[model samples]
Target chain A: MTSSTTLRQESVRETRAPVEVRGLHRAYGARQVIRGLDLRVQAGEFLCLLGPSGCGKTTLLRTLAGLDAADAGEVDVPTQVAIVFQEPRLLPWKRVDFNVRFGVAGTRGARAQALAALEEVGLADHADAWPGTLSGGQAQRVALARALVREPHLLLLDEPFAALDALTRIRMQALVRELVDRHRPATVLVTHDVEEAILLGDRVLVMAEGRIVRDSDTTGITRDAADAVALDVLRRDLLRELGVGG
Target chain B: MPFLLLLAWQLLASGGAIDERLFSSPAHTAHALWMLTTNGTLASNVLVSLRRSAIGLLLGVSTAVALATVSGLWRLGEELVDSTIQMVRTVPVFALTSVFVVWFGLGELSKELLIAMACFFPVYLNVHGGIRNVDRRLVEMAVAMGKGRRQIIRHVVLPGAMPQTLVGLRYSLSISVLALVVAETLNTTSGLGYLMANAQQYLDTDVIFACVVVYCLMGITADLVVRVLEWRTLAWRTGVGNR
Candidate 1:
């Protein structure tokens, strides 16, 4: 067990950068959301942006995903990028399978791909189920499946698991980690949860006032170490950054 | 309960509590219905009305959809057409009937054209609103997924706007029928409306009542057909109907 664990740790340590955003800025009317934000996501690496509400983490992620245009600066992204919003945002009129394969153009093999994606998310049984009938967690899983099926090179998540309960959130986090590792896509996750950042991210970026304050490598820490030391340290550091605590 | 109410109405009319001249007894109305059915005039008039309504509905809905699509896609087109339609929609169908009769003469063309015009605005407005009201996020998602304009329209915009369009279609259908009847009365020599108008001249209240009943039945049937279409086309929106 120790040997296998060490092997896993060593593998994750060798990260390759796939996406680079330099001095990205975004402003909504008078309020500047993301200002001079610079981020680099390694290929096959999980990076989490931790911040308080309105700290511009989501804005940064959206900018990276190309959903929101950057006000200034450059973003070098892969041709294929997928985003998972806080809400599932599934097409309510489509069944689970169709929603998963919504991005797949043309009809000939779309159904087959949709079914396969549903199977990947463990929702094959719900292929024909309407999106309205899905639970929150289930819907999020479908959304993740939707992103996954696109075979994206860069995956941006905007507090996707924030609304889920503790246990379901953990399960989903593990599922996401597994899928990311399998797909080997460069992933950027935005969240306010320090533990989540420490548990799932190879690197944790701390943001405040529309700028990144710190970027820490947590790749060397094991899950138990993350829970015991890394998370607590990151939490204190993030709180301090926000002027909440010393 | 409806039958009981009708029976009560029949009793009152037969007892002379209601004037038989204006309010014909149910039995007399039923007898008139039977006579019309036997004479085949009712069936022919019904066929004529049905044909006009079907043509008007088809033309109205297709034209509305085509116009809405074009306008929704192009800003300049929308600006030009939207104001014009809104202005025209304010003109009452009854008021337009005389103008149509004068322009097209006392024929099926005038009646059909008037019905189509009446049906056009409601559907066009709803479809336009539906397209405009589509969630921007969904459109962005589609664009991110590399969907072209046509694909977005086919997969996202049409489906999202369907419920609202269907509601408009239902309203337009009923309006079409009402307008068709009025148009028929004003211009055509045949149709249920014409039969009722002629009966009124002779003070044939039973025939008038029978024609009115037939009109109500046609309206109800049209509504039911639309409901069925809604159910079938929007099977994806099963529970969303209540909303």
Candidate 2:
């Protein structure tokens, strides 16, 4: 029994990449969105995708999350995927707690887990409050709690903090980093912010026109005195690649 | 305001400011109402009208809801049902009473059909519009969370559409009353319209006024019931005004 259990675990580890895409192609009518994009994300890796608007960053994320079908591609993504969009997307008619457990089944277990997730986000007191009463940041926290309660294998964030104020955005960024580290789900964050990519990513890949242009390893430069200078240089390079002045 | 209006009306009628043949004093109308109720005339007519309107509203509103759900949730249902409803809705439903009388012989069937037709449009339009207007982002979120199609409709679609659906319900309630008034005019030996018509010959303005007051009260009561339903089902909708 022990041998079979070990074998099953080993087989799982050997076979499944959290996310994989090869020669992906997607189009909207005559215009192409993703053009032969190829990439892989390992389990527990945090990859940040930095690109200009309309450069297929969101499209790629949606495709991987299975919210949109790819026109043609070899894509292998875990079925257990959760996404956080720029909008909170909480159902207005639902209470905050129910929204957190939006799609989870087994009512009793889901409610318990949802409350725990709300507690993690410091919103346990708002369990019965209507979503309409929540402030933007509070609503977004509920959204994050909703995603987290799923215990997803792949977490996709599409500019989840883009609508927030600077202070709230920073706080949310820290929360996301903390969650990602603690839970260690393979994460893909799509952002237009070069600084955000630098701060939160294990690997940052710059994309232009649906294909990756610059891929870098920034695993060593997070909050270390020895790598501060390297981080700055990388930031400058990334900004230039994104067609923004550093 | 209504009480003040009634007071002014009573003063005008009692003081002989308007012709007695046309206008009756509120006290006289009240007396007529008392007499009619004691004799069971008002009770029987009100019961008849109420029963007809209730059945018509139930049938019409349920059909509207079912069709709207099918059309709103599926492209095929929309294609098959929506265009036809839109075209039919453009025709004044009350104007079909003549054709209905000819076909159904001025019976209860024609009156009920007329009332149902009147109730159908507003409910159907509001429900369809509400369902269609549900935020696509929320639906996408549900899909991302791995909810099935039926589950999406249950959790996201229905609740999201509820406010608009209730608005439609309120509109249909008023429309149903209006239709019931018109429908009661067809081959009626029964209902408030019959009492009013009988009073018209004798120039018994007090009875006519009493019937009018009863109709007004019925309309107001239906509106109040719908308002209470909105309040109960939509408690979570407090922070934002109805969208």
Candidate 3:
């Protein structure tokens, strides 16, 4: 699995790359959602996209996931991609373990892999539980486990933890960070939470009116004592850019 | 509750206010049921009736599923099948009995075809609606996870639509048994419906009551079968009464 991952990354970088959107444009009949956007995410990069409602971050993510066609320009992503939506989006009839194995191909050692993924999300004990029985936080964790189990070259998350309680949201953000770090997929998380962006991303891109307006490096901005003020300043600047408190 | 109804029926019969020709008492009905069972013809007739219903139901359910899947998946297929089916379904099923008899003769074919027609629409409508109602976000999620078209249908769409499909099947099961009654009564020489029809001619209230009991048992059995299937297949439903 590790070898294939590196090999795919090498081939991807040699040609179209894992996730490279350049001069992208998308429109919904009368209204445009993305316009000539250019962004490149390296393999193993955790990039958080932050924007107000209607800023096209979700549209960009959907385009990358291949759920929608790009009206123009390039969206070069690996064909094997996984997505975790705002809802768990589970097949309710299936058990919890099967839901976590949603993107996986077959049952050859799949149960163990699904269990391992569930273990990563701290829900291994609930692997047999139904999705309907899960709390929102647990369901979102299963969604995360599902996205990671396929060893996807790219993982797209669209506000996956936004519906959870505040404490659950914090724990989920940390869980996502850990999973992304361990699995090392090219991750793109779209969320409106500025602090979540700072806490979880290697870099943060602020989008507005279908274009990226702020590209801030969030690496070492949270844990490093020296960068405490820098982190605070970046947070305030992002909030200001988003028309939040000055 | 059933025992109380039986006791009330016994009391009514003993009171002698109601005529026996109109209805048989519980003891009389039970005695007639025993006689029919001991005579050895009732078992074969019940088997024949059940077989016809099962075959007709199978054929109907298979066709309904195929057409429903086609219409549910593609816009062109829907345009071709959905509206046409909707129009045909509105025509009362029994109204086609004469036309079916003229076309296929009074053999088992006509009866089975009629039963199939009767069973078809309910299953088709419910399964089609179920497929169309499968969560759009779930399909989106599956597509985003890189599942191909066949994989999406097999793994996602089919299971997602199964609850509604089962409801359709449950309804069809009931109609199948009762359709057997209609079909058997029309031109059959055997089966419980034949016995009932023959008893109607002679005013054999006890025998008619026995046949009615068999029909009720068949209906109840069909329902219990569906309940068992639902229990096994739909264990995931949280609020389901059974599990």
Candidate 1 DockQ, CA atoms: 0.46
Which ranges in model 3 have alpha carbons more than 4 Å from their true place? A1-18, B238-243
TM-scores of the candidates are: 0.92, 0.94, 0.93
Q: For each candidate, what is the lDDT?
A: 0.83, 0.87, 0.85
lDDT of model 2 at position B177: 84
List candidate 1 stretches off by more than 4 Å: A1-17, A223-227, B239-243
True contacts kept of each: 0.45, 0.84, 0.71
* Model 2 lDDT per residue over B30-110, tens place: 999999999999999999999888888988999999999989989999999999999999999878999999988877888
Q: Which candidate gets the maximum DockQ versus the true structure? A: 2
The order of the candidates by lDDT, greatest first, is 2, 3, 1
Error at A240, model 3, angstroms:
1.6
Residue-level error in angstroms, candidate 2, position A130? 0.8
lDDT of 1 by residue, B1-243 (tens): 999999999999988899999999999999999999999999999899989988988888899988987787689979888888888888887787788888988878888888888899889999999999988888887876777888889888989999889988999989988987787777457888889989999999999999989989989998998899999878877755443
- TM-score of the second chain for every model: 0.95, 0.95, 0.95
Model 3, A109-186: lDDT tens per residue?
699999998898899999888888888898888988888888887889999988999999888888888888887889
Cα distance off (Å), candidate 3, residue B146: 1.4
Stretch of 10 with least lDDT, candidate 2 chain B: B234-243
Better of 2 and 3 by lDDT: 2
Across all models, the iRMS values in order are 2.7, 2.7, 2.4
